[model samples]
Target: MPVNLPEIESMELYPVAGVKLGWAQGHIKKANRKDVLVIELCEGASVAGVFTLNRFCAAPVTLCRQHLAGNKGIRALVVNTGCANAGTGEQGMLDAKKTCNAVAELLAIPQDAVLPFSTGVILENLPMDRLLAALPNAVNNLAEDNWKDAAYSIMTTDVAPKAVSEQLNIAGKQVVVTGISKGAGMIHPNMATMLGYLATDAGIEQSLLTEITKEIADLSFNCISVDGDTSTNDSFIIIASGQSEVQFNSREQAGFAELYQSLLASAQKLAQAIVRDGEGATKFMSVNVHGAKTMAEAKAVGFAIGKSPLVKTAFFASDPNLGRILAAIGYAARECDSLNDLDTNLIDLYLGDVLVADKGGLAKSYKEADGQNIMNRAEIDMTVKLNRGDVDVTIWTCDFSYEYVRINADYRS
Candidate 1:
């Protein structure tokens, strides 16, 4: 069950002019489910991506870097669920290459222009025969309004399809931004976790698109955690089709800021949806850490609180265990590998607006009932203040529950 998240009943996924999507059931692992996706990009589209930092990254991830580095422009994206081509050694790389090659051949584009992605069970080889056989069908089924199906096709353990769409006027032209993301566990993204694809029809330079992709990812995908275990196939990609005819030369252009804001908002909604649908999650939490010396420190502090099993369980039980939060903060502070720089005496903590801890201990005005009232909500706001500087960051997470344990323990079955 998802935590306080609503199903996208109408699924108003807007179509960018240069993008088309399709899916097929290759029976790679399961039967009767659409487990493969193909996203076809037009000839002039600009694409950029940020991938997982895991050293044991998947074969598709390696190929994606190589394809993007070739600077030949991305033409198509081939993705499969049910068999993550990871931990299969050189064979995995070959399988990823073969999938890319098939897509490129079918689309009549250069092999280097195709990027492949996979998710689901690791340490297994991709069923090349089934995947390659389905390529032509997926290609034939491509459509501009298949975003809803594409969203569902990429899901692994996600309870529902995650997608968002936004439209804003850029230079008097209607610019559309639409995106989808999927992840229910193993989510602490070093660069970007799970898989997210955001596309815009507004015209922008390739270099600017790459820069903004990383910038928006830091504020969105990189700020969320589900199980604190980073996956080997995490990737987030952004494509600018330049189909809207609203050209912008620099960030100072009139419509660029609005476009950027709309894109970021859409990306953030997709990211938060993943946390709300976190595997076995019952509560959605916003962990904010403020007054840090740098953005990195603030993020570290927020992630520490968000990833703490003790704190997560407390949230699940609606227990105002203030000590658990403080302990997590201290541990996170030390984990930063910086000098012993955190001073508890200068810290303050709040559950919603009720101050629970101050000067390193329980606040003078602390009340358990107030904390309990806030904790009882399906959505929670946790704030930590380290009266040391001005920087702040927020991370999204979910309360762990019995279902989370059950889901993972029997995941492979």
Candidate 2:
């Protein structure tokens, strides 16, 4: 039941100058526990965000995008679970704006400073009064060091909460990066069904924050998969409090570039944790596609393999169904010179070196005992070498099981 990834530390030790962590109970479909969270950032802090690309994205995303475009920096974040403010049409938009206004009023900040996000059943009108009632208590509980609690409060069907932090030394000052995210199903990112919040104590320019956020997202959230279903609500935001006082001007080329790379690594670590905890996931999987003519082609092959039902189901079965892997690649790939040209004899499909599949077909060596042993592990890696060209890409996914179906099918009930 334990996760196999490295233990991700929390960044609570850092001094966050202008942020408060708070949560409110109730307002959920099965209310009884805290489901609303509020993060109040200090005035003049820079904010950057990434959202789902689904055409039917939630009302909150549209509003957030509009605000960000206007360059109206945020000072507050209001998040809720149990009622995704989506698909309710114009009414949902009004409710979302009203929710933000309420939080702004409570915190005495501008409405544009309040960014709102929601998760859970779509098409239901948000319970504004219930959520508003809990805001005072949530604000009262706000603390400088509650990253773990903030991560846990946003869960819907997730089995465990996800949070990560890292400290990097730059120009003699330690920059702290802390992040938390929630995702279990309806995942397969054009960014997925999830919300991620990243906070940093280091001082960085808004332009740099914008660039780093976009680049980091391409490698992390954009490269994960679960059930291949994109949601109407997916959001990730980063807040730079500038508490570290480590300023980086565009002129400081070397130092700034290095610092930006480190930030991306920290963000990527938090994103992978969400995929590892994917619903009904017995094993966390990584799919690598190499030898493509272009990055687009490589990503296409990666996602095709990652989202394949046959490949995922075979993974759940631990059957080492290499044929399914090849099938997915063949179907999703843009161009491959010859399927038969692949070196089937030298191919090694290993379940921890068990060699369940060889070359282009199932290993005559596939055994039930050996397969079951591999399936028992909490994490799995599926690697395919095209041996065609030089391009490469990797993506994360979890096994598909009946539990996954049950969770999503009855998600609203």
**Best of the candidates, lDDT:** 1
lDDT of 2 by residue, 153-209 (tens): 888887777777667777777777777888888887768788988887766678878
Model 1 weakest 10-residue run by lDDT? 332-341
Residue 388 displacement in candidate 1 (angstroms)? 0.9
List per-prediction Cα lDDT, in the order shown: 0.90, 0.76
The residue pairs that clash in candidate 2, if any, are: 25-34, 291-389, 344-359, 344-360
Best by TM-score: 1
Q: What's the lDDT for candidate 2?
A: 0.76
